[model samples]
Target: MDRPSYGYSAADAPPPQGPTGGPSEQPVCPRHPDRVSYVRCKRCDRPACPDCQRPTDVGVLCVDCERELARQQASTRPRTAMGGRMGRGAPVVTYTLIALNVLVFVGQTLAPQIVEQLGIFAPFRALAMPWTFLTAGFLHGGVLHLALNMYALWIMGQYLERTLGPARYAALFLVSVLGGHTAVYVIADPMGYSWLTGTVGASGGVFGLFAAAFIVGRRMGGQVAQIGVLIALNLLITFTVPNISWQGHLGGLVLGAALTAGMYALRPKASPGADRQALARRSALVHGALVVAAVLLCAVLVAVKTLLVLGG
Candidate 1:
């Protein structure tokens, strides 16, 4: 029953007016001041147009607020379970090692004379050319030799660098190389052809990585049978294959295993409420001292061997 329609329909109603009786001003988006918007961001409660809004878990946020929140989050870098600073998730140290090895190989190929200058010829000569103890690890005999070692280094370096942290992993590698060369020095017959043989390769450091990876895998409950098998096969090859330095491989493996065990045993106990940064620093200092001690042991071995060879 259509009586005289007294109530106004929405379409027929007048626009809302301000106190001055003029049309009310529309709220403009903070990001886009020219655009009028009734929708407000849940975060800052600012009027934001569709273009300036971002969907969040709770509600929509303004673009400015969302960007600021992201910036804050990015500033806080994350740490690994072992207290390694995980920056961008790339293994920087591993890649650096691979590059350095490749570059040195190139140098070796270009200038053949550099090989003698770098390779560990004999303990007696190593005394005069001390740098060979470290540099020899970077020299490879041929393309096949370089490829095999670089492949192994690439595989194991990435994992150890991340887990043990870069500095500790690097220490482990250097010490391993030193141990391998020292073994070669100690085991060689001073009056034999082995003494005159120049040994060059990253086999020492690579074997060390194998031992470390095995220990780490066993600790983390990972499947380590494959690593064990690989090591056994390599050891077999070291004995069977002619020109292979069995002494170096065995020495590096033994020392690497021992050092890794010590480092893990000394690691600070994890606590939910403990300060990770503090714990990581403590672990670093302890691990660093252990590495230094290992180096000293290698030095002592070399010194004693040097005296014996010279005296005889």
Candidate 2:
């Protein structure tokens, strides 16, 4: 680099002279068009001016020899996905699920259940009766009950969706509700079931979301005290409330936590380093296994209950 005698900035002068290039006559930095390069490579010990300096692990490398070494180093290093960083921090799926829940809730409140139906039930069964699990989440037994569960779902779900993304979050909610519904079926006198007081509300799903949030906090959150307080409050209300589905809520909560952990372990995360594709493949297998397991368990329970009744 050349410096004008009369008008010179610090950068206009060349770096110290050395074997590679005299500092007084070094090339300008490519990035900084007029900047002098002071660093000669540690390895080469040649004076490298700015234009020829190459980035390296510990220091700037000689441009002539270091490019090959840098390429090899990069190749050997484990690669990670560059995009979708902080994906866990922000996901559209979380907000969308929340919106859907609120929409369903509002619609259920205004619509007449007399002539119409709240269409949530058994999900993807042989019968494909989604109205069981689906409607159960939307319909509430009373105004207070509806308000409480909806608020809880919105609050905790916001966190779960942010952490787990849409698919896992939805899976967690449904699993939790199904756990609760399963508990109900186990204890209920449903053989004599009627249309009146059978099922309603998001308690099961909300409880599941709560459990997932707590588990997520335990695993990943820096502070878990808030999560603990949340669990405590929800449990207190479940027990104290006159018509709370205690079994449903508890079962759903436990199942949600366990399954969320399982999903996380199997896949680790949604992006970059977590091996998400592998996780998804394994999850699909696991889900199929769970569905089969649930069906068998239900069949056994129904058979045993029926057999006992007949004997009686």
Candidate 3:
């Protein structure tokens, strides 16, 4: 003091202030009141401790804000190429098919004569009412039969419709039905089984859907054990149960698997120039080919059966 203080003294020092040039005040985390923090959340502008912070592209955000942002992003995600909306929307195809089946069942109940005309009979007689090949799929012998078949259809149709879209799904189903009837025509008479004379039910198409579900599930990396078990149980029932069409079920299963396999094989490969629309067109062509092949096979089967019966 006597020498006039060569070094700076305490009286000349600046006062301490907060980061924003205001008087210093301790800031506690909003989530944890006891924890003091100098950092603020980028989203909410509230004090956040390291434990409650989630780092983002802009800056760190609080846990609550981060959760909200994630929810928003998920809600805005786009639909898949196959028209699936990430669990949103009703399965329109499945519902329409169920309605049609129910309507047909009601009509069958009202007009009992429709069964004899529409139901598929032995191959020789079935040829006379060729349309019965498809009509039989819509006709059910009893309430329990209709209920079981419709229930199976509903369960499998939703998944397939979502995965394959409506047009492809419809084609697969119709082709599968034809395939089932074709199998019966080829096998029933040659086996000389009197009980297999008349066959009626949507079990053929239902079996086809079962096969489709298994194929799709496997493709999507899902566990297919349950589907396989269900298929096995149904097949066992088809062979062992009275009045069940084992031939139809086997034919449908084979055709469904073949059609799905064909589609998978024909799936368009990604290229720099090709767009999604182009790929969709190619897929449609594949489906068309499968349908045509199914129809031709049915015709050939009928012809062969007729020849064998005539020759014998």
- Which candidate achieves the best lDDT against the true structure? 1
Listed per model in order, the count of residue pairs whose N, CA or C atoms clash below 3 Å is 0, 18, 0
- Tens-place lDDT digits, model 2, residues 83-193: 111234454655665566567667766875741253644212312443464456656656677667767777786766656655556666766777676666555554444
Once fitted onto the true fold, the runs of candidate 3 whose alpha carbons sit more than 4 angstroms away are 1-88, 190-196
Q: What's the CA error at residue 62 for candidate 3, in Å?
A: 45
Candidate 1 Cα RMSD (Å):
11.0
Candidate 1 residue pairs in backbone clash: none
For candidate 1, the lDDT comes to 0.80
- What is residue 47's positional error in candidate 3, in angstroms? 52
Q: Who wins the TM-score comparison? A: 1
Winner by lDDT between candidate 3 and candidate 1: 1
> Per-residue lDDT tens digits of candidate 3, residues 1-312?
232322322223233345676645677675675667777777666667889988888999778778877766644554333322333478787787788778888887787786556665556567778888887887777899999998999889888887887777777887788888888888875557642477778888888889988988888889999999999999989889987888999998998888877776666664665454455556567667867887787898889878987797
* Model 3 lowest lDDT segment of ten: 5-14
lDDT of each: 0.80, 0.59, 0.75
How do the predictions measure up, each by TM-score? 0.73, 0.56, 0.70
Clashes counted in candidate 1 amount to: 0
lDDT of 1 by residue, 30-110 (tens): 556567778766656667789998888989977877886775554345654445556346878778888888888888878
Q: Once model 1 is optimally superposed onto the true structure by TM-score, how far is the C-alpha of residue 210 displaced, in angstroms?
A: 0.2
